[model samples]
Target: MATSVSVAGFHKPLYSTTFHGGWGTSICGDNSTVLIKSVPEAVRVVKPVRFLPVMKNINEGKGLFAPVVVLARNIIGKKRFNQLRGKAIALHSQVITEFCKSIGADAKQRQGLIRLAKKNGERLGFLA
Candidate 1:
């Protein structure tokens, strides 16, 4: 649903407003009650459960696996997917943390390992 807002004063030729994901604007010639139509609410985006925002690579099956991602999104839905993905990522991070602790590795080593993993992933190509 879209809503219109009334501004009483603003004697300006152009007025504008912005929202996340995009922007909109309005224009008026004189100082009057301006009825600016607000941009409609953005359609809620359903991010895939398996997608990691941290991975900035393009070949992470964004195009090739789009169909599968859509199917999974339809099956698992937004809320459940979020819950599961969050738990899974947390668990993986915890495991990595524990392993680092056991190895007496500092932050630098952990980051280096992460970089090495990225490099290996790129070499593997399918998952990069």
Candidate 2:
């Protein structure tokens, strides 16, 4: 007797019982059977994949233009560099908010878009 298991688009007997009470043999597609211990009423659970977004600033001195950032950091110093980056990001966000208002988008929609931008930007190694 064979025990059937359906997965994906493949419908076939996953394992066959040769005798009583010890083991079951699973048939591979290439016509090979491997012995697997049989258990009653087994439930299989697969873990879902989770994605983590990485947040990194370009000015932290990494990438093709690392040298440029290093030089800028050296010249402008840490405090001023942070100030410029903060100002630029704030200006960009303001521009987005203004554009959204101009388009007659509601506050809820605008907030959602802003949050999405932050998430996507963080994933893409930009300012969040």
Residue 36's lDDT within candidate 2 is 28
Error of 2 at 51 (Å): 27
Error of 1 at 77 (Å): 1.1
Q: What do the candidate models score in CA lDDT, each in turn?
A: 0.54, 0.61
Span of ten consecutive residues with least summed lDDT in model 2: 31-40
**TM-score of predicted structure 2:** 0.40
Model 1 misplaced stretches (Cα beyond 4 Å): 1-57, 62-70, 114-128
- Alpha-carbon RMSD, candidate 1: 13.2
Q: Write the per-residue lDDT of candidate 2 for residues 24-78, one digit (tens) a residue.
A: 2223334323322222336422577787879646444334555665577679998
Mark the regions of model 2 whose C-alpha exceeds 4 Å error after superposition: 1-71
TM-score of each: 0.40, 0.40
